[model samples]
Target chain A: MSEGLTFHFNVDGEDFTSAGQASVMMKKNLRQLGLPPEIIRRVSVAMYEGEINMVIHAGGGVADVNVTENYVEIILTDSGPGIKDIEQAMQEGFSTATDSIRSLGFGAGMGLPNMKRYSDYMHIDSEVGKGTTITMRVNIN
Target chain B: MTVKELAETDIFSPVTLPCGGREISGVYIGDLLSWVMGRASSGQAWITIMSNVNILAVASLADTSCIILAEGVTLEQEIIDTAREKEINILKSEKSIYDIAVFLSKII
Candidate 1:
């Protein structure tokens, strides 16, 4: 078996329904790589949340995943409106999503929190009107 | 109740899926992803109005057997395709999430 694997995807913001495609592929890849179910679940959940946030808030972005024997790393970068209040945005139930977004079944304000909760490490870099970059890692050990 | 019976219920009766008659028990209704993550049980049917791929991810984490997309909402073709590959059953109803949940409660 290969020692590691890397996967990349461009999240298209034009379609919210398509947001989790990359995460699904990553899960499939990790499963083929023979990773544990728990690890794959954690990575998939974390990346799925990031991918959704990218679409719902940032208008889409790029995702890079590095899968290794010990941990999985996911980096998501987007050029959408930067978060104004990172702290508040991180809080569960706090959301700035439009009613339209909410009606589509997202913008519940759980994206960031779920990402943080499922990953072992998470970092957010953003500026208002600029862009946001999130890095999350899940340990397999 | 099994997924088939849930599918047979008036609210969900119209929608048809390719899920091979998997049995489903209980139901979890919520749009709040985090709350559902913490509260939803594995193997239960998740009814939501959300039409995003993250719904599949959340269901996977909670170990849900299938998801019923309420409100006559349509999921993207890609999402449906991936769910099939993931072995996750997905059903869509013409009813709203609320109405579907109510129906699910009475039956299950």
Candidate 2:
């Protein structure tokens, strides 16, 4: 397979239990494509963190993954309450998630940081009233 | 210690898989995400009551051997299925996360 691969999914925020389905499926699909384990792990982890953020922070979102020879690009866009402070949101141990979300073991405030840590590149665009869109890329090399 | 030993020590019985049990290793227990992210090693079994899919995501990033969900917690099927597909072993027990962590630390 010399061509690039692309995959897309609609992340449902209604059910917190099913939040990471898209990332999980993508991880499996990338592994089946025979990508390196490191690459697959990075892509999945980055995408998974992004997916969780979308669920916990935004109501729902759309994720598009473009896999090419050089790198894998993940674009996650959400239509929910936007981030008021990206800097604070990126800080470790700083979370605005409700107690209910914390009980589920998330909302540790590690979502955005984790995404940035695992991805080769990351970009965030958001407004207070508008929704947020995050672009993250993990290199295949 | 192996997960089987964890099962025996704790009253809770977790579903078992044979991917990473052959390699017995240490255990890490913490709810603090930052510490775990930077310090948790590969091949060490992570014991946490945290049941979010992010747990699986963190485990993947840390390259952990498996994740043990304690305190009689029931993980969402998405988490179980995701961990399974990722080849990450997931176990659930009746023991609290604290109790299992202490027990596993002494054994390993």
Candidate 3:
């Protein structure tokens, strides 16, 4: 395969049901490139959780996946009400999702934690009223 | 048992069997999407009361052999169609989640 490849998508926050499309597509693309199964799974789970967070919390967002020789990187950005507390948000059982989101079987306060769990490295940048940017990387080795 | 073999039995109905021949290594029961996504192992059959498009995404991410919709749960035709296209084996049962898990424990 080439040294580097990229995929970009616009996550639709309007329909909660439609979230994760970007992750699925990224999984397929990574599969086609013949990446290791475990790496692909890690990337998929991390990206899926990030996508769900964007849908439930952020109004919507843009996701960019960069596949390089060393690792796969995912960057998700949104112009939604930013996270007020990164520390609390990282806690496994803390969440601000509404009851409706809970009924849908999501908003369980595991999104950020799961993302961190699956990806080898993760970073979050947010402004309370401005926006949020999340970057995660899963190594190929 | 394979997904198709399990579906052939009367206890569960096949909602979609796009990957019927896949072997079901084990069974996982949970309704929380993130919990299931993190815990469910590949080749296992995930049982849940939650039926939605998101379920399909979780199943795919977890690489489960199939999804068992217990307690008579179902998906809309559109979602079922999507499951088929995604090659995600899905089954349904009128039994409760606990009962289905019990049944699977005896067989899987």
Candidate 4:
């Protein structure tokens, strides 16, 4: 437990019903590691938002969580349509999700904002035609 | 108040009580899953009109006492099965979110 632990998950984009499965499993892993509840909640929320975004916008992706003594880092990589404007996407209510996605109780444009709010640090890398990757970290302290 | 007591009320009808016997400390009303995830606290009942399966994720993450599907929203079979498997309580209510919230405030 001194060095760090990394967990990887494949997010299924086809089934909207199973979108948050990765985040749920991540929460359980964090609990087993004896991380603080606050840290676990923050990481879980941030990762869950990213996972949902990947499903709704990016059509699924890969999630990697790195747990260390100081912080937990979540990396989401998707191969779907990438974001055109990172700044605008970071806004609380700006979204490009379809009407159907909104009907599912998501696509409120709060996903990225919530991720940033809960995490200690966040970074977004995207190419409009290529894909998007989001990295968020939460401090253990 | 315990979840059993709330379920007995006229407004709330328990669908599955995987973990409904626990005490409820408060109420949070919201439809947005991420918003509810960020705001709802542990031991609270979440009232929402959304009947998607993701609500179970939010409830489990937030550790809500039970989820009340307000406005007579019927949950899909997938959601009900998942809730049972996950051991989370799912309830149904014919009342609106506003009315459910009011009743919850008065009681719990």
Best of the candidates, lDDT: 3
Q: Write the per-residue lDDT of candidate 3 for residues B7-99, one digit (tens) a residue.
A: 998899899998899999998889999989888888999999998789999999888999999988878999999999999999999998888
**Error in Å for residue A96 of model 2:** 1.7
- Whole-model Cα lDDT per candidate? 0.78, 0.77, 0.92, 0.89
**Top TM-score: which candidate number?**
3
What tens digits encode model 1's per-residue C-alpha lDDT throughout A35-140? 8877777787788878888888888999999887678999999999999989999998898889977776667778788889889999999998989999999988
Enumerate residue pairs that collide in model 1: B3-B24
Error of 4 at B55 (Å): 1.1
In terms of lDDT, the poorest run of 10 residues in model 4 chain A is A100-109
Candidate 4 deviation (Cα RMSD)? 1.4
Q: lDDT tens digits, residues B1-108, model 2?
A: 665555555454655454745354678887654346545666777877676666766676666777777777677776677777766777777777777777776777
By the TM-score metric, which is better: model 2 or model 3?
3
CA error at residue A81 for candidate 1, angstroms: 2.6
In candidate 4, what are the lDDT values of residues A40-141, reduced to their tens digit? Answer: 888888999999999898889999999999999999999988988899999988988888888878888889999999999999999988999899999997
Output DockQ, candidate 4: 0.78
Q: Score the docking of each candidate (DockQ).
A: 0.38, 0.34, 0.84, 0.78
Misplaced by over 4 Å in model 4 are none
Clash totals for all candidate models: 1, 0, 0, 0
| Clashing residue pairs found in predicted model 2 | none
Rank candidates, lDDT, best first: 3, 4, 1, 2
Per-model interface RMSD values are: 3.0, 3.6, 0.7, 1.0
Worst 10 residues of 1 chain A by lDDT: A100-109
For every model in order, the TM-score on chain A comes to 0.94, 0.96, 0.97, 0.97
Residue A14 of model 4, lDDT score: 96
Please list the residue runs of candidate 2 whose C-alpha ends up more than 4 Å from where it truly belongs after superposition: A1-3, B1-13, B18-25, B32-42, B51-63, B71-99, B102-107
